[model samples]
Target: MANNSLLEIKRSLEPHVGAKVLLRANGGRRKTIERTGVLEETYPSVFIVKLDQEQHAFKRVSYSYADILTESVEVTVCNDEGQVRIEYLQQ
Candidate 1:
């Protein structure tokens, strides 16, 4: 049942592939890592973010949809107008 719910969230994000997004993830011990990237790809259980490397080396990060659902990770997609579209995956 939980898998089905996750699939729904994944589907909702499919159209945002290639869109610019800000990713915030908890790194444990009160640390948080934030990055700006393009929504590179989405899979059955996870989505990848291709990070901007202007200030550092290029990197790609993946986070499960479940993480969003649980608020463990936060993603904010930016539209062409420069407005932020936030997705709050309900529990």
Candidate 2:
């Protein structure tokens, strides 16, 4: 089990979805993929995700490269009206 709380992970990954993500493909290839969406369909692992420019959704298994890629994720949770600030990240 991961030491981090699910809420924390969920909160961190929320706003970052549909944002650009750097993916390390097979054979050391690196490409940028825009995160289409996130789905916590199952617990403990498996956050459903859809890729930008694609329709099919994929299950991004937790703790894998997919998850690690979000390690650098930056999210900003704002209040209604898009004026009042709520939360955000610097790194």
Candidate 3:
């Protein structure tokens, strides 16, 4: 499933809490910032990621599902089995 709608996207990510994920977010001027973290929590409007201390300056970041819908941020879940990289689309 592409997880197009915001509710669908949230539902899709709900099971992956506490898993490792790589986030690529646009920082402006074509800059893409990468961060690896644990999937902390998911709420009605946004989801939180706890950043790895070794690689990032800030501790944790929260992003809205809308960001995913707009393609401003990308999330890739890393697991022992494999990586789950799904592209989200807006309904």
Candidate 4:
């Protein structure tokens, strides 16, 4: 059942590949980081975001959908048509 749910989330995100996204995550020690990137890919267990690099080399970050489900991360996807979708994994 758990695997099925993850699959569903993956499917929902597939269409948003290449869409702009804002990722907000809580680092340790009460610190948080927000990144803007393109939704690069969605794998079975995780999703990748290609970060917009200004001064450094290209970088990609991967986070499991479970992070959203656990509220450890928040993802906001903005489509080309000006539609925005926010996803958070819930129990």
Which lDDT tens digits does candidate 4 get at residues 1-91?
Answer: 7666667667778888998898889897998888889999888799999999973265999999777766788888877677565564446
Q: Highest TM-score among the candidates is held by which one?
A: 3
TM-score of 2: 0.33
Candidate 3 per-residue C-alpha lDDT over 9-84 given as tens digits, one digit per residue, 9 for 90 to 100: 8988899999999999999998999999999999999999999999889999999988888889899999999999
Provide the global lDDT of candidate 3 against the true structure. 0.89
Point out the worst 10-residue segment of candidate 2 by lDDT. Answer: 82-91
Candidate 3: segments with Cα more than 4 A from true spot: 1-4, 89-91
TM-score winner, 3 or 4: 3
Task: Candidate 2: give its CA RMSD in angstroms.
Answer: 7.3
Residue 22, model 4, lDDT: 89
lDDT of all predictions:
0.84, 0.37, 0.89, 0.80
**Poorly placed runs, candidate 2 (over 4 Å):** 5-7, 11-28, 38-42, 50-91
Worst 10 residues of 4 by lDDT: 82-91
What clash count goes with each model? 0, 0, 0, 2
How high is the lDDT of residue 33 in model 3? 94
In model 3, the Cα lDDT at residue 70 comes to 84
